[model samples]
Target: MAKYTEEEIRNFKKITCKIAGDYLGVSSMAVSIGMRNDLLPIGFAIKKDDDRYSESWSYHIVDERLIAYKHGKINELQIQNIEKNLNTIIEQFEEMKKDLLFILSEDVD
Candidate 1:
């Protein structure tokens, strides 16, 4: 991955998945999946449920975190913190999923 200066990254109105993926020499889907799975600490990946059968992903990357991740500056402590946060998010998502399922089942009945 090539290192990007803060100024260069700040110039972008939005740091999209494609832009980040290009810098990291990976496809946009790879970037999205990485972020979703908490393997990449460069950004936030939110999965949006558009309907019962469709979902889409949205990403919001922190410029500083992207630069730090690209430059290999993310410390072990930060990684641990990210993991902790990821776990919490997973738990919350599970709860939300269960609630949605219950609501849908009621509609089906």
Candidate 2:
């Protein structure tokens, strides 16, 4: 992958899985799996439960982070921070899920 400039990276609102996989010379599934497992530092992969037994993944790739990761510029500290933030987000999501469940169970006249 070529080194992208700040302006070029800034032009993207969010990088799609296909685009990221193409840049990294991997399949979209590989990218998704990597993000889902926290192996990729470029973005987030949120698992969305569609039904009782089915689920899908949603990706949100930060362009700046992707560029930094592609160029090997992300340090261990940055990766640790990213993991910490990801954990916080997961906790918040779990709380939101609980709130939604409670709201749905409430009786309304």
Q: Quantify all predictions' global Cα lDDT against the true fold.
A: 0.84, 0.80
Name the TM-score of candidate 2. Answer: 0.62
Model 2 — which ten-residue stretch has the worst lDDT?
A: 1-10
**lDDT, candidate 2, 1-109, per-residue tens:** 4444566666867778777776667887888898898888888888887767878789998887777877799854797987799999999999999998888889552
For model 1, state the Cα shift of residue 60 in Å.
0.6
Global local distance difference test of model 2 = 0.80
What global local distance difference test value does model 1 have? 0.84
Candidate no. 1 TM-score: 0.63
Give lDDT tens digits, candidate 1, residues 17-93: 88888777788888999999988888788988876787877899888788888889995479789879999999999
Error of 2 at 27 (Å): 1.5
Note the residue pairs that clash in candidate 1.
none
Q: Looking at candidate 2, what is the lDDT of residue 67? A: 73
Using lDDT as the measure, which candidate wins? 1
Query: How do the predictions measure up, each by TM-score?
Result: 0.63, 0.62
- Model 1 superposed RMSD (Cα): 9.3
- Model 1 lowest lDDT segment of ten: 1-10
Q: Candidate 1 at residue 3, lDDT?
A: 45
